[model samples]
Target: MDDINAWVWWLVGAAGLGIPLVVTAMPEFGMLSVGAVAAAVAAGLGGGVVLQVLVFVIVSVALIAVVRPVAARHRTQLPELATGIEALKGKQAIVLERVDGSGAGRVKLGGEIWSARSLDGTQAYEVGQEVDVVDIDGATAIVM
Candidate 1:
């Protein structure tokens, strides 16, 4: 252990930390990997083991404290645009068939025909009536 250069060990530690970071896709490990790289830089600059460890600790703590919150915020952020069936909700559709709880009906939504059911089982829509899509239930649209 004493034969190997300290900087080489630090770089190796960085690589070791980075491997798990990639495998697990965890930001914390990435932060630690970056800290290991900083430690390696300290060792390369002739800083002793204690100084290298200090550098690693400081860099890792700083990244966890600062970057982690921002990353979490981005992870939980709402998408800028909604795609797929989500885009169908709240849209206006024209009924193509009589809609009721008694039977399945059809509607023209976003230029596509979709199975539709009345939001209230008691209510119904005749052909050519306009309805608002409340939500999507499987391949069916709940409309009112």
Candidate 2:
């Protein structure tokens, strides 16, 4: 009976850990929350005090080391910004209209039209000149 209880405890802990691992590997599941639940189950099913602490530490550390980087990489692959004309930075654009001292003009970049200004605030950009976008200010790009 004692041996059966120990086996049950170990089986429960293993199942807890294994379920989360399998579920998280699926593209549709979120890993961090799943890992947390797994760690909790491992600790809960560890049977005695020493086993509980050991299982908790081992499961928690393993899950963190394995799952966090995956989540971070997944997050980084998504777009960081949702709006505005900041997409024009570091791209080359052609001046469609001359920009005078007042800093108002139009440019074509990446097959899209954009409002542009000179970064130096002094150069008079002429029509049909290729320029590099250096900064974005609201709807305007500072180009040079």
Candidate 3:
């Protein structure tokens, strides 16, 4: 220990941390590995053991504190894209045929003809009427 340089030890620690990061796929370990690299730089700059340790702790904590929340927010966020059936909901359609709750009709939706029905059981939509699609049930669109 006495013969080896402090920077060498820091580099070795960094490698040790990096191995677990790869295995576990935990970003925290990567942050710690980066901190170890910072400590190695400090050691090469002639920092005392206490200063090297301080640098390591500060860098690691700072990264975890800042990056963790951002990563979590991104993980929990809903995707911007709405595809397939999800994309059809909340869209406007032109009634091609009379649409009423009791019976199925036709509408032009997203440049395609879709089987449609009224959202309310008693309500009816006339031909050429514009209606808002409330939901999709199987191949049919429920509109109002």
lDDT of 1: 0.93
The lDDT ranking, best first, is 3, 1, 2
- Report lDDT per candidate: 0.93, 0.68, 0.95
Candidate 1 segments whose C-alpha is farther than 4 A from its true place: none
lDDT of 1 by residue, 1-144 (tens): 989989999889999999998999998998999999999999999999899999999999999999999999999999989899898889999999999875489999999999999989999999999999999999899999
Best candidate per lDDT, number? Answer: 3
Q: Please count the clashing residue pairs in each candidate, in the order shown.
A: 0, 0, 0
Candidates arranged by TM-score, highest first: 1, 3, 2
Per-residue accuracy of model 2 over 35-135 as CA lDDT, tens digit each: 33544555456656465556556655676778778877987796777455656678898999996546679988889887888887788789998999888
TM-score computed on alpha carbons, candidate 2: 0.53
lDDT: which is higher, 2 or 3?
3
Report the C-alpha lDDT of model 3 over 1-144, residue by residue, as the tens digit: 999999999999999999999999999999999999999999999999999999999999999999989999999999899999999999999999999996579999999999999989899999999999999998889999
TM per prediction: 0.91, 0.53, 0.64
